[model samples]
Target: MSAQKVLKLSDLKQDAAVRVVIDDIPIAVVLDSNGEVHAIGDTCTHGDISLSDGFVEGETLECWAHGSAFSLRTGRPLNLPAYEPVPVYEVTIDGDDILIDPHVTKEVN
Candidate 1:
């Protein structure tokens, strides 16, 4: 599927996460303090909670309910309670637009 414009780059705040649903696929869009944009699955593997409602620490998004931190780059859980890694979508920055394809995800090693 082609990438869809989810939000404007200026719409994101540094070190925070926003929830966006594209084609019924929920995703968490984050703009780190380093000024890099990342897209990952919004659901917490440990619980039925929105990762976007959680905290952003460095390159990880911590689940508010279980305190499981998921990597923004790889979507891997950095801590316990969540061994499953979430999907990480590739983010395309076109000027101020943030594009993402929900069907396309980055290969994490």
Candidate 2:
């Protein structure tokens, strides 16, 4: 499927993560303090917890359960207990809308 509108940019709070599901895929959409938008897999690789429920630290999203921080850009875990990186999706902005395609992810290697 092509890119779909997940939410409006205005609806997002700065440095906060908003969880959106597209095609049964859970994604965490974040509007960082730098006024940049990011989209990553909502599920934490270390635990099955939702990353949206975690805290946003700079450009990283910290999992609330185990304190594992995942990079908003590369989706790599920067802490212990989460050696695996999550998927990072490409974000598109049109007017006030944020679009994300679940199947499309940025190369992390």
Candidate 3:
């Protein structure tokens, strides 16, 4: 599997989302309210809206185009309009850099 370079941790602001392409998969990199980073599929299960343009509230990422909210950690849909869970990636902190493994099923190393 080929891992793709997404972004640096320093480039992400707290409570913000960034769109990135990893392994040809469009992913949303979110920095939660508590300064935690999460990686999830960019596609919104409710609509075609990109989750990267959404709002980060606490551990949930709210879709900007709709009202649906999702858990950044588990990719679970937390609100209406979306019942299916999106794919979540494993994240690792390498110094000041943030690394993501989109194909991994286990905890990030």
Q: Which candidate is the best by TM-score?
A: 1
- For residues 7-104, could you state the per-residue lDDT of candidate 1 as single tens digits? 99999999999999999999999999899999999999989799999999899999999899999999999989999999999999999999999999
Candidates in order, TM-scores: namely: 0.98, 0.98, 0.89
Ranking by lDDT: 1, 2, 3
Q: Scored by CA lDDT, what does every candidate get?
A: 0.96, 0.96, 0.84
Task: Name the runs in model 1 displaced over 4 angstroms.
Answer: none
Relative to the unseen true structure, what is the C-alpha lDDT of residue 30 in candidate 1, on a scale of 0 to 100?
97
lDDT for predicted candidate 2 compared with the true structure: 0.96
Q: Give the per-residue lDDT digits (tens) of candidate 2, residues 1-109.
A: 8899999999999989999999999999999999999999999998899999999989999999999999999999999899999999999999999999999999977
Q: Worst 10-residue stretch by lDDT in candidate 1?
A: 41-50
Per the 3 Å backbone cut-off, how many clashing residue pairs does candidate 1 have? Answer: 0
Candidate 2 local lDDT, residue 5: 99
Per-residue C-alpha lDDT of model 3 across residues 1-109, encoded as one tens digit per residue = 6444568889999999999887677889988878888888899999988998888889988898878999888888998989988888878877877887778743422
